[model samples]
Target: MLDYKVRTYEEAIEVIKEIGFLPLTQLVPNYPSLDSITSKEHWHTGSELDPWLWRAIFPGDGVAAYGKFVKKKSVLISSELLPLTRSTLGSPRSVNERYQDGLMSREAVELYTLISENEGIDTRVLRVQAGMKDKDMKKPFDNGLLELQGFMDIVVSGTKAKTNEAGEKNGWSSTSFETMDYWAEKNKIGKATIKVDKAKMKLKDHFTSFCSPETMKAIYKIFKF
Candidate 1:
């Protein structure tokens, strides 16, 4: 288990590297949430610490944060291990497959197409461009974003603070999303060396090594494997 007192981005990265992948909050048995493991007293009371970690690890030209795993939150999967995980999860579908599979909703296709066409985009701008600016579209828009992330078709590149009409910061940031292929290519990350079945077995063995049997059961339930 990681020392339950992470106080810095470096420490957080260390823990993530050790565990392979972890959630931002405590969920799976035996795995520690980023907040639960923080040593900073001020961070213990609420979710203030999460954004700091997000800002530090994402974007900036490296695959430091695997931003989609459980609960559509960040999952720290090291760049070295990304290929294996991607292989296990399966490849990103072509445009036709993505639309036809019934896995992606109409909003998801629109959002994904915008990101792909533009190379990358901030979430705030993406919503507007995708015609999801209406308040009623929030849930579907959010779900579409999560669905794309879950499928490994897209990933967060970084964050930009929301601003008011006066150009003042709103104290909240919107994440930037990009196609996984774009990010991987730009970063020079390679494709999976192993086949899907082999990747799955390897990933399972790796997970089993650190996660308890109960945790394993929970993982299986979540992934439905």
Candidate 2:
């Protein structure tokens, strides 16, 4: 029960952040009949979950079968609010890193609040399902998703305001941007030019040449900024 109950992808991330999503997403699928199951996986980077990927399957949870995951050690659990691990696994990384590897949604936030305020269970086993529509947070001053969207727009726009010795300013990760840009050009019908205008950047102007609103939101959320 460690994943947000989400219908659309955005609705899901709007609650749990990210830390609490990935593992739970995959685990639930494993046993469509299993309820309230707790599972863990090897956090490859010892950081947050890769912000770009949100699969309904967590193949890594079967690390025991592959002899890749340790058991009964303190492990970190990730969700929307922050990355934290209180696992019994004695994990090599900190709670923050574990949380990063997991993803959560905003609904998960309300779920946790509702549970803590009522359930009387001091556990963090979140489950994604159909429930009452939780109230929304006020318009975020740009959530992490928008923030990175803007930042990536700047980076992918292929323009830099300032430059390091190599001429770079405010340049975010190029690797992810390149992949996104390539796919965009290949798929987009208009195939407009993707350009970054640093001085004119605004979260409101989500017109990056490559990303759609949903994909932009998803990839940005993955970074957890």
Candidate 3:
């Protein structure tokens, strides 16, 4: 259990660095969550200290990486552990190669290609660009996004506000996507030569510091490693 509660954006960043990663919400058994650690009063207040706001800001600020890495659930990962996690969870084959091998869906490959080519694109715009704008395409588009994230191929880099032709902002902001390679380069996280087995071991040991045995088992089950 965390001895101190996280009450500020800076504190939350420090926690992620110290713990290696923190789920956006409670996920794995006994895992700490941003919601659980933070003071309740500041949530959804649109304040700088709000954890919800941090989710939309951390990646853009290079403070931490935001993605669906933990059991395919959203989490904030420290820069130090980001590459290791990628190496452990990601496929050794290229996206195209995986698609050719029938390991990935065509929709996922299309999304990956677009995300890698662009600096960063919001999902709302990305859907239209990928011809998934219709309501029926929502599930496939969403699934493809998650598939890329599961492979550590892309990440949530920032959030963008919706705008009208008149240049006025509309509705809530949408999460922006970018290739993991782009995010790593921007953050100065070098791709290392760690083997998959070693990388998994390292991450498991890091989590062992704070997780109970039951939690560790749950992680292994969820991650399938």
TM-score of 1: 0.84
Alpha-carbon shift of residue 211 in model 1 (angstroms): 2.6
Tens digits of lDDT, candidate 2, 67-184: 0011211111222111111111123333234346663344333443433333222111212121432334322311322322222210121211333697656443221112122223
Candidate 2 whole-model C-alpha lDDT, 0 to 1:
0.26
lDDT of 1 by residue, 56-147 (tens): 35444474545665567666566666787777664545655867977668888888889998765888888888888999999999998888
Query: After aligning candidate 1 to the native by TM-score, how far in Å is the CA of 206 from where it should be?
Result: 1.6
**Candidates, ranked, lDDT:** 3, 1, 2
Positional deviation of 3 in candidate 3, in angstroms?
A: 3.5
Give the true-structure RMSD of model 1.
3.1
Give the Cα error of residue 173 in candidate 2, in Å: 6.3
Best by lDDT: 3
Clashes (backbone N, CA, C under 3 Å), per candidate, total 0, 52, 0
Worst 10 residues of 2 by lDDT: 61-70
Task: State each model's CA lDDT, in order.
Answer: 0.71, 0.26, 0.84
Candidate 2: stretches off by over 4 Å: 1-9, 14-21, 28-76, 79-84, 91-225
Candidate 1 or 2, higher TM-score?
Answer: 1
